[model samples]
Target: MKNESIQPPRFSSALDPIPDYLTHYFERTAGPFLNICDLDDEEVQKIREFELSNDIKWSRFKMWPEFMKSRKAADDLLMRLYEEKFQKSPAHRPVFAVLGDFHEIPCLYANPGSVRIEIADLREDEVTFMYPDHAHLIQFFDHDAPAFGVPLPENYSEERMPCWGKLFTYQDLHEIHVEYGIKKAIERCLNTPGSFVFSYVEAHIWTRDLKFTPIDHEPTGKCKKA
Candidate 1:
């Protein structure tokens, strides 16, 4: 019996590319390589004050405190995990990207754009990290990870975690693919429509600087038409 009442996931598409590379999506206006935690306390306070004065309801200003806490907790855990694995600390607030081509990730932003970067593009000295899904949200809220969307497979283990409980390096990309490749990651999201969690595998690029394409903003939002 066909259950047409169960609407399919909105973002997954037959045309979504299963690319050989990764992509960093951002607001073209802001350009790429920006991290919110980079802001100093005073600067953040100024923005918070400004936003509250302007009467913006549920603004990022109001959420800054808890968000920062979550972000820092995740970042600290990532640093510890990476250092333990690689014998050195990775740079704080590395640029965020996702393995393969995922259209839904970019749509989370107000003005989305992407620049594709591949493993070959990285310098030999550069270090990178990856997780099967968004690192911060998953790592910080691990208690809710396994049951995020559909119930996880009965055999789910650390080797098959769907979120940030695990971290991988560029050297581990091949092994990662064998464990949870692009196709599987996409399918996980597709299985649960109307939920953005576990949408794609996240790749954290660590470098002092990076080269990126110019502003290529595509106006889209989950709540509004593109």
Candidate 2:
């Protein structure tokens, strides 16, 4: 995994070496179980197929300014489809959504009155719909932690390794899903060793937002950004 010549599996233009810090985190924590993703892997195919099946269009945008105009366009279509097509009220709608990109991070959408139709806003870069009850969700958000694909600092603590590369809402951890022993798992990751953690923060949009570019449809020896 330390080969300097080892490129990032043809989906990204990143020539950066896979950091030793990431390797250490992987070794120290239950990194594989944390469910981080590689774009050029089979795990991503599910979301890709979902997008194609739904005819969700893809575009390249990373800035709010760049995405705003089209965000409304996508929003209009998605809102109409969701509200008029599959209209579900807050209680009837899902408690959370599992955004299926290369990574599978969950998110909270419905509240007292409205369900989030803005979800279609991410269709290009992320796809899929996974309905989660309060029983199966947890969230964390540490501003100090690194975002996905960003390198970790030298001398990073193994204790905080599980906190890296994920989003935190800081709400669901306390606000919702008080049962099903989700906190027990969260504590295991933050307190003990070799633990797996999940988050409900929409880390995907906040981390990359309009800046996220889709990787190639299939893994290859060369980069083919979508």
TM-score of each: 0.65, 0.19
lDDT of 1 by residue, 1-226 (tens): 1222222123433213433455676655566776656878786566556645543323444544455555555555656766777687776656777665556665444445677565576763354545444344333346332222233345766555543355666556555555555446656665466545456666777774664433233333342333
Query: Which residue segments of model 2 deviate by more than 4 Å?
Result: 1-174, 198-203, 206-226
How much lDDT does candidate 1 score? 0.53
- Candidate 2 lDDT by residue in tens digits, 2-107: 2122222222111022111110001111212122222343544543343334321121122122322333333233323234323431111112222222111111
In order, candidate lDDTs are 0.53, 0.24
**Candidate maximizing TM-score:** 1
